[model samples]
Target: MAPALSDILRITSSLLVLMLLMFCMGAINLEAQVGNLAPDEVEALLEVATQLGKRGWNRNMKLCNNTKLPLKPDADNEVVCNCSFPGGTCHVVAIYLKRQDLNGSLPKAIEKLPHLKHLDLWANYLSGNIPPEWANTTLELLSIGVNRLTGKIPGYLGRITTLRSLNIQNNMFSGTVPPELGGLVNLENLTLSANYLTGELPQALTNLNGLKELRLSSNNFTGRIPDFIQRWKQLDTLEIQSGGFTGPIPSSISVLTSLTDLKISNLLGDGSDFPNLESIAGIKYLYLTWNMFTGPIPDWINERDARYGIDLSYNNFTSEAKYRETLNLFKSTWGGNYSKPVEFLIVCSE
Candidate 1:
């Protein structure tokens, strides 16, 4: 019993419609998965807000759409966004919650922010070590200093090659600076001061050829300052006050012709004459205190009128008269106990 032609045609039409409907549904699912700002990331943001004590944002509110909403930010709380997707979806790009006294563990959910580049939580009360999940982002500036964070700085941070400025000073980070950090070829400014870090500077750090400024003051490090610092040809400012290192300034440091500011205080071992700074044509500030330096103070200190300020107090210089003749110890606090980052642009002189 063959079915009638019209019935067969009708059945085929229904089946084709059903198939088309299924295909459309699958396409919609794929779009939701790959196109818009990911749902998981939004959820991650909510988790971050919850952990960070930010109670303003909610899930139903669109992050990018509600840009004009008054969120009553305090203590530099901010959440930057970018919304140029085909369907107007958005992405979190940066989160600056500095000076907020946020007392919580750094959430692992930060890895979900695919477009995030900056995450500055400096001067917070946050505790605990940095989560390994943070390494998954493309961060450029990661400043978390002046916090109560503890534990060893993970070597995985070196994997964040995009980092330009990394300031983890004034924390309780222990252990040695990871040698793997040499992988950050683009890193420019690095501050690891006021930590409980020990051990000599890793020789692998010579690979930071692009380094601009480096601060390692107030640490419990040992051994002589490595001569490998000559590799930092682009270095502008170098600070090493009370770093628990002994011996003279590496003579090779004179090769850093780009240096504008130089600081090395509280050396426990032997010291030599003023470093050869004739190559540094534009030297500005110099802080060389509490060291066992010998010999006469360089007369060139006055020769460079462009020199902004110079501090050579409490050193064992042989020529007491000359040391006093050409010195200005009036720029900063005692022992280089800087509570925050310094501004090098504005030079202070006597």
Candidate 2:
């Protein structure tokens, strides 16, 4: 009968190529068990550890005080918090156990932990905030810094723009400062220091221009410090202390030649001095102490260059002998003959 109909069409084409190679090996073993811990993610992590062991939660202490809980990553049933190795310098790649202290809230099945990145629950006493579906995933590092986090810092976190590092510093984050965080242009490190952040200063954070480190100190920020803040030319550290900055400090900020550390101390109050700060000739650690600076302590503060460490003690400097001749010319050109003051700390002790 025509050779049994060509052997039943070559045995139905070899059982359809062995059922398409067993459906591509079961779709690559469900994409390598999608980083394991399945079974409805361990039944939603034992139903969030049976609702935090029914409140008396203490699955082995260490909840704060440099917090610990991350250490496990062999895959399988997941739940291996943080397994560091000599490899990727691991920081919670899969199950960080989101905003720990499993009290209440946040368990909408945890959006099914699709390889969480790092969700440190800042000062957690975790309450309700930031759960708009967690802006839909793909986190790198999101600290709820000093929690009690009220609303408004989450404009969907600008969609987690490949966040490098972000800390919602000392939370209770009030309105503003979310100029969409400049869409996290690969943020290097940012902390909205002491929140309650107000308007201005968030022109999308000068578009983050790849900030190196910026902390908008003790917020309530007003305007006029933005000449694009010298475009953060790889800025090393610039803290705008107790914001409400009026004007005049921008002598183009000495073109920010990789600012070492400059803190414009306690804004416009007690003798605020910013008269071009001797052009910060590569400031080493200047903190223009308590503001409202008036005149005389700036003949370049006796022409500083003594590897710099000027504090300009409590402003309105009437030059106590020109601040003791600029601390004896920074203890004689940064080395000191006055009982070894090589690293000066002139507080004017007032």
Candidate 3:
């Protein structure tokens, strides 16, 4: 009454094929799910990326490997690759790994994401050189400061014209600053202090039309301050201390009307030739210590009153009552405005 033994074998084989078909179909469905995940699914993926762990990268072969999309799909089934936050997509536009236990070099896979804009990996244990591919990407802000990165800074980074801030201070970067950095026209803030950079300050940096803060202190840089820096109208703070700088500070720097804090010391030359102090302008806290400036204190401090606080201590300035100037003075502006001079103190010992 039942099916013959031979027929049973055939039926069993057919059933096996059906099972395989279902397995293959399920795999396809999972793959397609990545491209069709709902809004909530994308948020989960972003959360995973944030937890990249002490290595700061997910290196597992199947790790979120195409199992998820950057953003939720539209009604038309098209998935978005990159969109800012609040759009509710899985797209990883920026990575904030500050003060994390993150270690090791950045993954080369980072360059594959064409829309990456911000990268903050400060205060991490990250070591090794930044990948050269970083130069080709479109980063708006790169903060790798306070890391253990070594090797010459990628000169190619100068090619990134869209960058607004570049902070790589407190690293082991050596060699001269890349003059090629002149190409970054949109640069607003650059902090390369406390490195091993040498050579003269590049005059080409004047080309950075939008530069506002330029810090190159505590390095091995030699030669005089670049006079062309006066062209950077937006520059507010200019610090160049504890270096091998020789020659007088350029008088033209006074033209940077926006300057607020200016420090120029440890010079190998005289500071008197740094222009008649009276001509200098701006609300500046000036420090000209530990130099061979031989002359009387310039009358500028006497003229500008409060806003032009200065520190010429330990220099060769001829002033009898140098200690008397330490007293703060409240001077009245012409418009019945009373302003006090915030005395800037400079201490140097032999």
Enumerate clash totals for all models, in the order shown: 0, 13, 1
Best by lDDT: 1
Q: Model 1 clash pairs?
A: none
Candidate 2, residues 1-350, lDDT tens digits: the string is 36797798899999999999999999975444333223454455555456333243343432211114443322222234332333312222443443444444434444455556665544545545677676676766776566566767778777778877787777677777667778878887887788787777666677778787777787787766778877778887777777766645666777777777777766643333446755546666777555656655656665665655666554554443234333432222112123423345633210
Greater lDDT among 2 and 3 belongs to 3
Which stretches in model 3 have alpha-carbon errors above 4 Å?
1-90, 274-281, 303-309, 320-350
- Tens-digit per-residue lDDT, 160-224, candidate 1: 99999899999999999999899999999999999999998898898999999999999999998
User: Order the candidates by lDDT, highest first — what do you get?
Assistant: 1, 3, 2
Instruction: Assess candidate 1 and give its lDDT.
Output: 0.77
Q: Pairing residues by index, what is the TM-score of model 3?
A: 0.68
lDDT of model 2 at position 250: 60
* Least accurate 10 contiguous residues by lDDT in model 3: 329-338
The most accurate candidate by TM-score is: 1
Every model's TM-score: 0.78, 0.34, 0.68
